[model samples]
Target: MKPTRFIDSVNCAIEGILHATRTQKHMRYHFLAALAVLFTTLLLRVSSMEFMLLALAVSFVLFAELMNTAVEIVVDMISPGYHPLAKLAKDVAAGAVLVAAFGTAIMGYLVLARYVLPWQKAGLEMIGTESETGMVVSVVLVLIVVVIMKARGGTGTPLEGGGVSGHSAVGFCIATSVALHTQDPLIAVFCFILAAMVSHSRLLLRIHRPREVVAGGLVGVAITVAVHLLFRAFG
Candidate 1:
């Protein structure tokens, strides 16, 4: 049977996906591992909004991968004889995917830290305990990014996970940390509200997408949970 143009396009896309899986098997494995960690440590414990954010980020990565595959195929077709420009184009496409994957992983880590290990470390009665240290770390990290962005005189890079905007990572961490420690429903509500506000601020300030903000939030909460589990196992 002859395939229609639409059918052919669909087949090409499916082939692209399969080719991506076959050629980038290690990359796919890494993504799947991250997803596993994300689901177990972050998604399970967060609010519905957090889960939505995770879904958005994951979708972004998948889209990036598809685009990357298309770019590679087009480049190969156009310059089958091998040209420097073709190599550059393909490299750039692959690089973009790497950046996206790296950003998502970082966001996942931040969320896990917050939800999994919100409290201070064991045997700490000092003024600057582990929890205090974590807060300080957060403050410093945020300020550093803000300062760097200011120094750059621009956003630096507006990729899906570039620039100093740690919307998904930091927001998730802070929100999850607050949610885990406080017993009151009001507290959870307030914490998430604050997180959402911060996320909105990122978009308003033109630093991130709604997706990025949500990713940060999920990563933060997930990280908290992961850390808690780790501590329990080792301690």
Candidate 2:
């Protein structure tokens, strides 16, 4: 393509992004979240590999949200009325955004949790950690339960829901498990603080309601605690 044509295409893409940012509240939230993620990455001084992963996750979420907006706009233009197919199309597009958002949240937690909860390494050493199998299993269980709840509620997709904050659930599960295994008061406090921040982020982003956040945290705490108890009893 000619330089002028390429420039026009770039301008059109920029205009679309600006239009979506202006019109879509969720898009604004995603932009803010991306900014916060970038700021946190800078503060943590993550390695180049970690930085690349974080950047890619952030970009994926924004791209998904933009595509979702475009899809909705196109569906509205074409259908222009309450049609089942149009609704399905919009929901599928929104689901894509939800998937991206959920993936980003998990990635952010994995990348940032260590930096924010610096005591975790010490705790792990103190516990003489055998394996992360228990924690991993607990996380998987929480996710399954959250997905089931969301499906039953029919309010949102499995990845994004008003039922429970999957991000908080997984984050706190790991945090609480680490705290319990370490049996350190300071570690426990810091872990809870980190978990609280995760919960607060969901509320701050308006992705989940206050009840949902609390429920998720409670679910995480309960599952982790139970798993630890069982391990102690058996082993």
Candidate 3:
């Protein structure tokens, strides 16, 4: 085939796959799952540069999957007959996807666990739910869930009830904790702004719906309120 024709074919194949990906729920699930995992594992907060690295790695896996599918389709079209070399090529492509996914998972676990483990221990200590401990516990729990969902490929928004709504949950939880710890309205206001931005950004990115964002805001506010009350009770 001519160069133009070859390029056109490649574009058409890509278009078809993307089209199918959007319409096919399963494909979307796979894509979203990967994204969610990266998001939650990295805590999806406006915290650090490590999260950006995690995001890049996850994106690489998705990109590899798309490329692998394209290569396989093109190969099949070129040589319909079974061939050893063709099989080898396909297998190699698949192996690439696996390697990318595995690496992504490992990085996620490392980055997340560094923060998640301690948070888990603290959360388990919130039985009374009547001290700064309670708020800390709530935040830790949310963080843990976010890490798990991200590693496992969830679709929650970090505050609602799904993959990573824990972002909002934990955000609010921390904001409240900070407010209680400092007992300063200015600090509380700052935390609230940061939390709100995180929630809004999640929706703006189209990674979450409106319900998810609202829930995150509410969760943060609620956590703050609860912690304030708990502290007041003890004081």
Candidate 3 clash figure, as a count: 9
All candidates in order of TM-score, best leading: 2, 1, 3
Displacement of the residue 3 alpha carbon in candidate 2, Å: 9.8
Best prediction by TM-score = 2
Off by over 4 Å in 2: 1-4, 119-235
Clashes of each: 25, 0, 9
| lDDT scores of the candidates, listed in order | 0.62, 0.83, 0.66
Report the candidate with higher lDDT, 1 versus 2.
2
lDDT of residue 235 for candidate 1: 43
Ranking by lDDT: 2, 3, 1
52-94: candidate 1 lDDT, tens digit per residue: 6666666667777878877977887888888999989988988
Per-residue C-alpha lDDT of model 3 across residues 174-231, encoded as one tens digit per residue: 7767655655544555787787777777777777677765665576566556555666
- In candidate 2, what are the lDDT values of residues 1-235, reduced to their tens digit? 5336877989888999999999999999999999999998898899999999999999999999999999999998999989999999999999999999989988987888878665656654555442367777778888888888777777867777658888888888988777766656556777888889988988888889998988888888888767766665676
lDDT of 3 at 157: 40
Give candidate 3 regions above 4 Å deviation.
1-17, 20-29, 38-46, 122-235
Identify the leading candidate in terms of lDDT.
Answer: 2
